[model samples]
Target: MDLKNLHVLQQLMDLSQDCFLVPGPVRMGQPCLNALSTPVMTARGPEFRDVMAHLNSGLRNAFNLAPSEPVRGVQSWSGDDDYKVVVVSGSGTAAMEMVIANRFRSNDLVLVPTNGKFGERVAEMCQRFCNVKHLKYEWGRAFDLYELERQLERGCYESLLICHNETSTGITQDAAAIAEMCARHNTSFILDGITSVGGMPVHPTEWKAEAVVVGAQKCTAGPSGIAAIAINSNFIERVHAIRDQGDSNPNYYLDLVAALKKGGDDQTPWTPAINLAMGWGAALDVLKNESNKVRWDRCETMANGVRNLFLDLGFELLADAEQRSSTVTSILYPEGIDDAWRARLKEEFNTQVIGAQDHLKGKMFRIGSMGETPISEMVEGCKRMIECFTQFGMELPKVDVESYFK
Candidate 1:
């Protein structure tokens, strides 16, 4: 087998032609692509330190944290001291697990509300280190805040973990309301902002989220294999107290304290994917150039455009209308259509979209509105979907696609 020249590789390369609509590992812009190709530099060298500085600042800005000014020689990075932002050489899940590992202990009680795959994952992670109480909902349904409050009113919870955006279901949680609940109860707020941070409104401090995790591959349109966290002083102080009691975090590489200490100096605790950091920093630059508000609005516009396009085609959406996310849109497949439609869309039209996860597989497909994916591309993707559906004996109603985006 000539593995190096596999046809599948060519098929992936063909993606450059146009149309990438998956929920994550989104289409990268030229700037990030150029940054990824830069010659690998020594991770511990001064130049990489500067790279880290820029990356840290970018991540902070995306999280809506106050800007920090670097004080020259003593500490290369010193802004936002109240919040420690750490970048790790792993995916968003690794960052989420790091939070659970460092902050929760066997004796702690945690409340996790699950309505999607990522929400279920947070509960699973918490179960490893703490007593987890799940306010579970059926997939595709929004969480019941009244029920959550009822649970919280019972007291004794040390932390609350939730996903800001449930990518798997294309539902954005009500962070503002949840934040108020967490504050009232005095529970540490941990958020999974993987698909939300850069694409939508994710103000960790404003939401009172003590710990938040973000993925580079999602909203930022950067390469995968890197994730970041934004956490406040309260989280750090609690972790220190836990360490002082001799119950240090089990995983060394993800040890929060060491990571935060090194991060303060614009460095990682271990060898990092330096190229990925450079790429992510470049992608974050694109985010900053547009400004957070405008970027967020664009995402909303894209999401609205995608949703309206699908709905006009007679497709039912998976998420509740009001809770639908600005980053992804999950659409239920029309009767007699299945996952095979996605392949035909890609094979015949050079368009790609994501399939459902878990039990929803084959029953639904998702279209991502995040990153550098152009609205025109998504509109084209929808057109391909229409063509594909027609071949399946389903003729969608004609719609003025331009009106959808507006």
Candidate 2:
């Protein structure tokens, strides 16, 4: 984790290519670099207001929220008031937690699916305030929809919590299917789209999602310390009802009522990381040039190329073919190779892939092709990986980089 060590190590083994293939904080080009040089602006100032509008407009355009979209109750936000985008001063998890704190109390019944780390995290975070019914599944396995329907029939849950893209296991759940299921059961949908939103297509209106959370880092191609929580207009009215009736929430920073009140003026209750917010706005502006479809296609191409590279090298993938994530790809390392194999990727090849989480530690490795990471990096890294793995005694055929560029 030492940057100094990595800096010295990058010049080794004639592997000069540096590919940052972790889930996030992704690489943002010049716009991001330019924002860092800007002085911090007051959250309530006109300059910050314009930047906030720009950032929210990008989200609006990406989600395709227009006059056609049905919005009710929430009308304070600018533009069409289709969706209320709450910019919080924390990592993606902050937005995730905000959804729980704002929507549910101890009396509310929340259903969560546990197939990966993020799903488990949301369930755990919700447990602090509300009743959570955990739907368990084995890691690396695709979600069992039949079982989910069975569970939905078992209880009258207030809201169904789901993570659209579970980064830990590289599985992107089908949102439209889940949304339809929720509609059938008369339940509101809350999605954790931290790894998906900007990198993939997200339909807030079509899916009928109540509130969804995303981070600046992962697919947004920005720095951390900010999480964007989007809530539909209908849900915002319910939030006001909670506050109007004096529903007491002990937490100050995450108090939905206070945040929503401040958000009406394009501001936060507490001082935010202004520089990072500015950088996030810049990132959104950069992404505006190309369509989200193209961005997602680029990510998928790189991901497929990387996955094929490892698969061709005789390494098995962790996720199934149907549910594989376009942003992050996790592959199981063979029996003999330990953590050193991953370390060698950084020190020897100047390429950094993600290490595995609990139970699969040292046995799995992940490569990120999300955000601004281009197909060129995957091609270069895969070729270098073939050479690196050969040194680890796992010899395999080389990848045809030219052919794999989709």
Candidate 3:
């Protein structure tokens, strides 16, 4: 396939022949692809309302926001019915900004902790909306809880924003501990679970988070440009208070109050990306049917396999071992390897992977373990990577890639 001659949309469809392992948007399954082909319907019609209802139900389940006990260590909450899952026709950042706009006032003090690119992004977004106290850390390192506690003790923070999964550096923060801390301080917690929600376990209700944002393209294996937010009763109450004060939220298109009003009838305030919503709904259904434990175990197995395979081949991981994410694995390049190695893996082996962002480019690469990628394809991709390393004049050892799966 001469990719250069093809249209950009055609190129997106043509790529990823053998192995699709980018962090996100990860490779989607056939069901989601079929859903994306469905004909558009009226946003206010009964048919679209049915679609919204289905999508909302599945999304609530995916976030562990519903009154369910099958998820690990989660109990039914009485306020479950008061919770709302709002879908927006934008990316995950849009959802994050919408929640921030509605939840915090200009005088509110917000604490933001950063360890990766997405964490930095949350701080950047909060700065525009409120008084932000930013905490910076080394990329791929875990946050210090004691320091966070000290900050909360000293500052009168109205809320704290953090990313549960830092996909850029493949790190998963200790969200349960953070939530507990937030509860003790009586501060609202806002979580960005873009890459963690469906691929692993996330209980917004149990965590007492005010709002949790998730991207459809990440763990859900759906098309891009769709995102959802899970909000609690307290969040809605605060949003109403903000609205009663009159136009405190400057955003017009990404207004959460308007979204909540329309959500009562299974509708959005404006025209939505109807096809993306269809595909997202189908992807959520698959995640629910498979159950949370099954999906978490599969992702854990794939992550361990990818990490072990790379370790045996003399590569180092970027994130700390204890905090590494199960959905995305970041591997540092060995002595003789460079970014060209990725091109060879894509062109010669038809395998797709992600390069590092910002200053880490050429120093590390990321491989995704989310979605429904088969174990056979991951094994083949690992072997191809080894072949490329050998071509770069690094003598490699014989690795039993299948043993990792076993």
Number of the top TM-score candidate: 1
Q: Candidate 2: what lDDT? A: 0.77
lDDT of each: 0.85, 0.77, 0.84
| Tens-place lDDT digits, model 3, residues 207-283 | 89988899999888888999999888899999889789874758899988888878767788899788888898899
TM-score of 3: 0.92
| Deviation of model 3 at 330, angstroms | 0.7
* Location of the lowest summed lDDT over 10 successive residues in candidate 1: 69-78
Q: What is candidate 2's lDDT per residue for 161-210, written digit by digit as tens?
A: 98888888888888889899988887889999899887777888889899
List the pairs of residues colliding in candidate 1.
68-79
Candidate 1 local distance difference test against the native: 0.85
Q: Could you give candidate 1's per-residue lDDT for residues 272-376 as a string of tens digits?
A: 889999999999989889888888888899899888888877789999888999999999998899988888778766788999999999999998888877777
Alpha-carbon deviation at 52 in model 2, angstroms: 1.7
Q: Pick the candidate with the highest lDDT.
A: 1
TM-score of each: 0.93, 0.91, 0.92
Locate the minimum summed-lDDT window of 10 residues in model 2.
67-76
For model 1, what is the alpha-carbon lDDT of residue 352? 89
